[model samples]
Target: MGIYKPKTYMVMISNVEPSTIHEAMTIPSWNQAVNDELQALIQNHTWDLVPVPTNRSLVGCKWLFKIKKNSDGCVARNKVRLVAQGFFQAARLDYHATFSPVVKANTVHQILTLVVSRKWKLQQVDVNNAFLNGDLA
Candidate 1:
């Protein structure tokens, strides 16, 4: 028997899904990395996947990929994400608690006014993938 070197395919954004068509083509290393990430998201409970239940709503997921570019249009990074199509989901059934702090406009205004009066510097910071920090109930 002869040794075989696996053929690779390139992922092209087109009318058909890259995975379905990949059998007839070669997949590039970059595309494989993106695919692997998508798989891990499912395995790691990033989102729960279930079949469409009768008399109930279901959320659909889509694969998203983008190539970050510099000002000169040169490729800098590759980002891949699997996101839910929110339209298919019902608020109470799909997502009941957002866990985001609820602050009224009046409350925000009052806080800002107090901050200004105290001459304190206002600062804002964001945590990346904050949802991942929470434990799954």
Candidate 2:
């Protein structure tokens, strides 16, 4: 009888996400993601260059990195976001009230149920930078 040998297979995994901007900069994909986000923000006129106010405290911001995946569990793209450190802000001194608009899952389910029951055609729309379109007083 002849001895049988089992073959070894090698797999490559490359889904490691960087937790800091310094580490992200080293990777080309992450660097491009950061650039893309900056370009989008600039194109949308998200912010303008302004002199720092002497009386008010400036809010600190940080870069956030995320790996977006497709439904088939494949890496779709690298996503980056710049977000303010709201936890550092004083409650009464910095702002009067804080509100975030978000739809509940139950509400979405109810809406979809109604649409299905009424036999109505449904359409979906995705508005990029929709929150940035809000007017800041």
Candidate number with greatest lDDT: 2
Over 4 Å off, model 1: 1-26, 39-43, 48-55, 90-131, 135-137
Q: What is the number of residue pairs that collide in model 2?
A: 0
TM-score of predicted model 2?
Answer: 0.63
Tens digits of per-residue lDDT, candidate 1, 1-137, equal 79999996554432323433243135454466466665666555665545666766555556565555558975554455555566665667757422322234565576678889999998842221212424322
How large an RMSD does model 1 have? Answer: 13.5
TM-score of every candidate? 0.43, 0.63
Q: Write the per-residue lDDT of candidate 2 for residues 74-136, one digit (tens) a residue.
A: 776777887767787687786633333334555557667888999998885233332344432
- Determine which window of 10 residues in candidate 2 has minimal summed lDDT: 128-137
User: Residue 61 of candidate 1: its Cα lDDT?
Assistant: 58
Taken over the whole model, the C-alpha lDDT of each candidate is 0.51, 0.69
